[model samples]
Target: MIRLYTKNAVLLAVVAAASYELAAEFGPWPALLTCAAAAAAASAAGAFLLRTSGVGRVTWRNRLAGYLIPWGWRLNRGKLWPIPVVSWAVWTAVCGAAVLLRPAPDQPALGTRAALLAAWVIDAAALVYLLGTLARATPGGRVGPIWKLVAVIAGVISASVGLYVGGQTTAALVVGGGPPVVVGGGFGLLLLFVVTVGRNTRWN
Candidate 1:
C-alpha cells in the first residue's frame, strides 16, 4: 500500500514539475505539495512497520512512553543516539535562518521563501540522518557497499542541491528554472534511497 502510494506521489511530483505554467496542465505547486505530504505519510507508515516487525513489543511500546529516559545520556541505547539530535538541531538552525530571512511584509505569509527554505532544510537533515544511519549500520557481510555508497551519494548531492536552490532563488518562484528541478531531483534521490534501504536491510 505504502509502496504504491509513494510511487504515485513521486510520479505526481515529476509530472507536476514538468508541466508547470503550461496552458492545460496541472502546476508545480500541486505536485510538490502532494509529494511532500506523501513523503511524510509514507515515512510514518514505514516507521510503524519497522517497530512492529519483531523488534519486541517492549521496544515498540516504550517508544511512545512519555518518560524522558535521555537517549544520548541516561538511556544509553546506541552510539547512534546523537545522530537524531544532530539531525534535528541542524534542521532547527536552518529554520531559524529562514525566519531571519523572511520576505517583505506584503508577501503571502507562507509564500516567504525563508519558511519554505527552512522546511527544506529540515527535510534534508532528516533524510541525511535516517538513510545515513542505515547505511552506516549496513554490514559488509550482507548488503554490498554499493548500496551504502548510493545512499550517501544520493542523499548528499540531492539534498545539498535542493537546499541550495531553495535558498538561492529570488522572490519569484518561477523566475529561475532551478527550485522545482532541485526539489524534484532531491525527492527522486530520496525515493531511491528508501527503496534501496528497504531492499538491503534486515531491519525490514
Candidate 2:
C-alpha cells in the first residue's frame, strides 16, 4: 500500500510538472489542446497496456473496493455508479474544460485565471484518482522493461510538454515564471526516479 501510494504520488507530480512546462511552452490554450490530444492517446495506450499487462479485466463491482474507499464519506459507495465508466467520463469532462477554459497567451482576465486554476485542480484530482485505480487493478502486475521505458518516455515527454505549455500560457498568469519550470522539471525528474526505484511491485 505504501509503495502504491508513493508511486501514484510521484506520477501525479510528474503529470502536474509536465502540464506546467507544456503550458509555459505552448501557452494555456494550445497546451491544453495538446494535452487533450496526448491524454486521449495516452488513455487509449493505457487501456492497451492494461490488457497486455493482463490487468484490464476490471468491472465496477470488482474495482471499486480498490480505489473508491479512499474517498470515505464524500461518496456514498452503496449508491455510486460504475467507477471505470465514471472515471473515464470525468477525464473527458476535465479535458473538455481544459480545452474550453485555458486562457489566452497574454495576461488573461481574472476570471480566466480563476477558471484555469479550477480546471487544473480538478485535473490533478482526477489524475490521482485514475492512477489509484490503475495501481490497484493489477495483482503482481510487474510490467516489462519495455513498458517501463514507455512509461518513462510517455511520462517525461507528455509532462514536460504539457506542463511547459500550461505554465507559460494558463498558469503563468497565476503562478508566474521560473517557478513553474523548476517545480515542473524537478517533479518530473523525481517521478522518473520513483518509477525506476519501484520497477517491480507485488503486494504479496
List, residue by residue over 58-175, the lDDT tens digit for candidate 2.
Answer: 6553333333222311222433333434434444444444443344546557465544445354344544444544544456666455355445434543443365365544433333
Question: lDDT of each prediction vs. the true structure?
Answer: 0.42, 0.47
- TM-score for candidate 1, please give it: 0.32
Off by over 4 Å in 1: 1-55, 58-61, 65-80, 103-109, 112-115, 122-204
Q: Residue 98 in candidate 2 has what lDDT?
A: 42
Judging by TM-score against the true structure, name the best candidate.
Answer: 2
- What TM-score, over all chains together, does every model reach? 0.32, 0.34
